[model samples]
Target: IDGFGGLRSKTKVITGVSLPASIESIKARLPVWNFDGSSTGQAPGEDSEVILKPQAVFRDPFRGGSNVLVMADCYTPGGEAIPTNTRAGAAALFAQKPEEESASGPRRPSHRAPRRSST
Candidate 1:
């Protein structure tokens, strides 16, 4: 997956204090790319075509306690340098929140068990 073996700056940890809108924005920017091989996403198509396709985002212990982890799949043009791509992409999309909302927090699952009828 993307950011599998990248640097600390690459992967990010969204604690249980992040906002839903922020999460959505980050999710929407999935499949992040580091074409210039830099932590800050910039200068596209300069060096390598490393892409990070976010597979899923869930609440887990990525940094410490229950937090949000942006899992992704790295890809390259030759399909032979997945590790490289992963590392690059990871450095690009770390802990980047949405532009508008500044509030933060985690969201609990909405699913609930069915109730049984009384006899």
Candidate 2:
């Protein structure tokens, strides 16, 4: 995961206003279990932070059964998009020095196949 092309930052928050009363209550009772940076200016009660809880809907499309979705806070800053889940692709492109020592060449493709002629 080192030497990613660029740094990517992203933040995901689940607020109470987006969920039902049940979720809000749950968050009120157990705010520690909720994601951080979710403070939505809601008043802080004696024991509750008046925060919103994520929606608690369970619907599975692949399994065709009830499922629970747990929300998480993901922060990715300047993250480079690397397809095929290749870690090496995320790193900086390798350049080769050519006739000009001051300049370098572009990264060559990792995989190349011989050309084929169509009949």
Error of 1 at 51 (Å): 0.9
Per-residue CA lDDT of model 2 for 66-118, tens digit only, reads 22243322222223231322322322332232333322223334557978989
Q: Model 2: residues >4 Å from true position, as ranges?
A: 1-33, 38-52, 70-119
Candidate 2's clash total is: 12
Per-residue error for 55 in candidate 1, Å, reads 1.0
Candidate 1, which segments miss by more than 4 Å at Cα? 1-9, 12-17, 21-26, 29-31, 35-47, 62-67, 77-119
Which lDDT tens digits does candidate 1 get at residues 25-110? 65674446433334333213454566556656765565544356775555565544454444445444443643544232233345
Return the TM-score for each candidate structure.
0.32, 0.17
lDDT of 2 at 105: 25
Number of colliding residue pairs in each model: 7, 12
TM-score, structure 1 vs. true: 0.32
User: Least lDDT summed over 10 consecutive residues: which range in candidate 2?
Assistant: 34-43
